[model samples]
Target chain A: MEFQGFRRKDGSVGTRNTIGILSTVVCANEVADDISRHVEGATAFMHQQGCCQTPVDIARVNETLIGLGKNPNLAAVLLVSLGCESTAVGEVAKAISEAGKRVETIVIQEVGGAAKSIAEGTLLVQDMVQEASRLERTSCPVRDLVLGLKCGSSDTTSGLAPNPALGIASDLLIEAGGTSILGEVTEFIGAEHLLALHARDEDVGKQILDLVKRMENRAKSAGQDIRGGQPTGGNIKGGLTTIEEKSLGAIAKAGTAPIQAVYEYGIAPQVKGLVVMDSPGREPEILTGLAAAGCTVIAFTTGRGAPQGFPFVPVIKITGNKVTWDKLRDHMDMDVSSVMEGEETLPDAGKRIFREILQVASGMLTKAEISGYTKAMDIYTVGPVI
Target chain B: MKNDAIMIHEKDNVATALRDIKPNEKVVVGTGDKSSVIQVQQPIPYGHKFAVRDIPGGEDILKYGEVMGRATQDIAGGTHAHIHNIESLRGRGDLER
Candidate 1:
């Protein structure tokens, strides 16, 4: 139940000690990326947000950036600002600094221009990375872990094998005192009532129902039926028939744990069991959303191979389809197709997945991370870029 | 049990084909008398579902013991059940409820 991890000064255990270069506005992403390109052990969280239209969206962008900076994975943070963006760079940096992580800020206009900001930002992140490098892995209990769950490009085998296996792993993690976050409220549409039955209380059950309804209504309000788009073409080709069937299969990834809490997109979890967050079912946005919510490790189940990974976290790609496992062997981290082939039991595959999670948390790099396929990611923003 | 097809729940009307099942193939659902053979009506591709019993058009397709969708065409028992034969009933814009 213990893994080697960097213990942050804030008393949180981190699976990775990274220096994050975050943009205060979309205009500053290039500088943030430039800084990360030059600094070792540093990465940029470049998103097309920060100079947005609506007040709610601007506030959401700022809060998500703050949470990402406060995540245990980041040993330090460097804020890259366009100087006049809506996001309050000073306030965000102050909050992160209060949490005991090394925080610094560089403004483009204030520092002269984009070129000047990049120069200053690179030097700052270099110093931060070196400081982060000084931290060493120590004894960290599994209870301190926040494991995020996601399933993408699904097929029938996903529900039959890897998903149930992941569910078992989710339950195992929860029993060991760790937290597991299940997001993608959009996937729970047809199976919302069923999933709600697993909530810890009536209130939580209602919240689960509300989130799914809200997600569906939001699509309807946009003048589009979720059915027209969901159970996507690929899903149908892969044998999925309805949103309910997909949702039924999708919920299996959370295992059999009771829903402990429900949260909005980009918000951190407060309770420690199985928490579900409101997020769309896309990889880049939802993956970034989960990372911002403070999950240090992510387990992604795919029946069709999904290769995207998070820049700041290790993503364990598990597949239950023998065809996909063979075609995308280099991308997948674990192949649990034996469960479907009747050669292995679900619990056995679940135990293997659990062991893989622990090993990855203890410094093992996944195929996606090793192949450097983790850089294209951004925060989830639903509003216009005006 | 090592299964060739699994009924996720007892009330489900469809069972997922664990592998590619040939036409007229017998798929075992449970143990001995508690089990029954569902003869395959067509080549059910791996990971797809088959009608455990005949389903009428316009009827709800049940899976995992819940209404997954509505059948678009009358489906014979053991025939492939997919998007070609089902339409989603949830998340419809014109749905009043």
Candidate 2:
């Protein structure tokens, strides 16, 4: 029920204690990446929606940036700003600082250019990294762990094996008073009604239904069937017949916990136990949203094999397909394929996944982390860039 | 406890093949204490679903005890039930104006 973690001054616990180099706008990504590259124990979050966007999306970018900075995994933060972008850089920096972490800002325009900015940011990041390194691991209760659940590249075994196994793990964590976030609203298409049955109240249930309706409406508004994009070609090849079938399997990741609350994309949960967040099923956006929602660690179930990880949060890739496990050994962290073979029961497999989660939270690097396959990241934004 | 195929819920009319099931193979499908044999009418690829009972055209395809979609054509028991035979009822912009 406990694991070694970095205890943040704000009372949250971190599975990793790294310096976060956050690009405030797409224009500042290179400078931020350069700074992170120069400093050990520093990771950069480079996103693509800080300028030329609707006010709603711009606000979303700013809020997501603040949420990322507030994540306990980052002991300190450095905002790399393009200076003229629409993102509220100063507000983001202040908000992060208020979260009781060291925060600094470097404006590329004020620093002359990208080259000079990178140099200045690199020095700032090196200092922050040194400060972050001073923080030692301490034992933190499972209650402090915020777990994010996601499944991608799903096939039939996904729902029957790893997804349900992960569900058990989520249930275990919740039973121990830990928090678990279920996202990927798009995947809830067909199974929303079933999920609503688990909601703590009628309003929460309605919210779950509404999130699915909104997601489906968005696809319909574009004058296309959601199936054309969802249940992707890989999913279809993997034997998922329709969005409804995919959803029934996907919802198995929620386990049996009562849904505590529902939140918009990138917003952190207010209550503990099980909650839902609105996010598309794509890896880039969902991972970013989960990170922004303050997940200390993420459990990603993939039937086919998805390799992406977050630059800061540790993503543990689990698979239920024997072939995927054998072929993508470098990307997978755990194999619950035994469940598919009926050699292992779902709860037993779930216990193994829960144990792996604790181990990863205690600093064991997942295959994704070890292979450095953590760079495909982006902030989920709605509306067009003007 | 049949290992060849699994019927997740008792109400499910379809079962998922744990391995490639050839045509005419009598596959045992069920979980725990409840199980039944289905003589497959067509090849059911690994991870694919096959109707455990005859599904009339336009009827809902049940999996995991929930409606996954509607059968587009009459699907005989033990035949592969997939996108070819079933279509989702939700998010069908094709049905919209």
Clashes of 2: 0
Where is the poorest 10-residue window by lDDT in model 1 chain A?
A219-228
RMSD of each candidate? 2.1, 1.2
- For candidate 2, the docking band is medium
For A1-386, candidate 2 gives per-residue lDDT tens digits of 79999998889999999898999999888889888878888898987889999999999998899999999999999999989999999999999999999999999899899999989888888888877788899988999999999999999999999999999999999999999999999899999999999999999999999999998988778666767588898999888999999999999999999999999999999999999999999998999999999998999999899999999999999999999999999999999999887789998999999999999999999887787787768988879989
Off by over 4 Å in 1: B1-4, B22-35, B94-97
- Local error of candidate 2 at residue B8 (angstroms): 1.3
Worst ten-residue run, lDDT, model 2 chain A? A219-228
Clashes of each: 1, 0
TM-score, structure 1 vs. true: 0.95
lDDT of 1 at A310: 83
Q: Which candidate ranks first by DockQ, i.e. highest?
A: 2
Model 1 lDDT per residue over A1-386, tens place: 79988898777888988888888888988888888888779878887778856887888888888988998989999999988899988889998887798899998998999788888888888888887887889989999999999998899888778999999998999999999999988899888888888999999999999998888887666554565478777777778888888988899888888998899997889889999998999888898889888999999999889998887888999999989999997789999998777788899999999999999998999998787787677677767766
